[model samples]
Target: MEVLLSLVVGALVAAAIYLMLSRDLLRFLFGLILISNAANLSIFVSGRLISGAPPLIEKGQDFPVGEVANALPQALVLTAIVIGFGLFAFALVLTLRAYRSLGTLDTDEMRVAEPKDPS
Candidate 1:
């Protein structure tokens, strides 16, 4: 299980990095989201995997919580999701503006927005 989890995290991180390197803004946005999810998964897995154990502790019970999931990672993931959504929306709007200004989705051509003033 540990090996599998490590492999999965590695794959996700690699793919996310690859996508982020692409010139397309949309792909970059997606890559950012993917990376965030991968990070969340990595943190969750670091806490160890447990099955069939409840997350909440019983009232008045002094015993330590069972080998269930830690809530911190879950909360962090939720926060990341919201942040990702906001970032994606902003990126989409920026992409739209870029498309409107350049009249093309290709990032390379947009680099030459103004003619080089070689006086």
Candidate 2:
């Protein structure tokens, strides 16, 4: 399972990079989302994938009886997910506004700093 997850993460990262290299702003935003997710998945996999027991102790027990899942990675992933969502939302809105104002979603053509040749 870990090997499979590693493969999946690798694929996602590859796809994200491919999308990020596109000339389209929207594609770059999508790549950002994909890469964030890939990072979360990588963190999750690094924490280990155990199916033994939950990360909770019984009422009488001071510690868990068997192997328990790590809570740190889960918490980290959750936090990352929320933050990523917010960032993605903001970027999407910003991109839409830029597209509307600039009349183009292509990164090269949306350049306002570099004026086009009059000729």
Q: What is the TM-score of each candidate against the true structure?
A: 0.77, 0.91
- State, as a TM-score between 0 and 1, how close model 2 is to the true structure: 0.91
Error of model 1, residue 7, in angstroms: 1.1
Q: Per-residue lDDT tens digits of candidate 2, residues 1-119? A: 99999999999999999999999999999999999999999999999998767878899998888888899999999999999999999999999999889999999898799988899
Model 2 has an lDDT value of: 0.95
By summed lDDT, which 10 consecutive residues of candidate 1 come out lowest?
62-71
Candidate closest to the true structure, highest TM-score:
2
Strongest candidate by lDDT = 2
lDDT of each structure? Answer: 0.80, 0.95
User: Alpha carbon lDDT of residue 118, candidate 1?
Assistant: 88
Which runs in model 1 stand beyond 4 Å of their true positions? 63-66, 112-119
lDDT of 1 by residue, 30-87 (tens): 8888887788788778766767465766889765475765667667778878887897
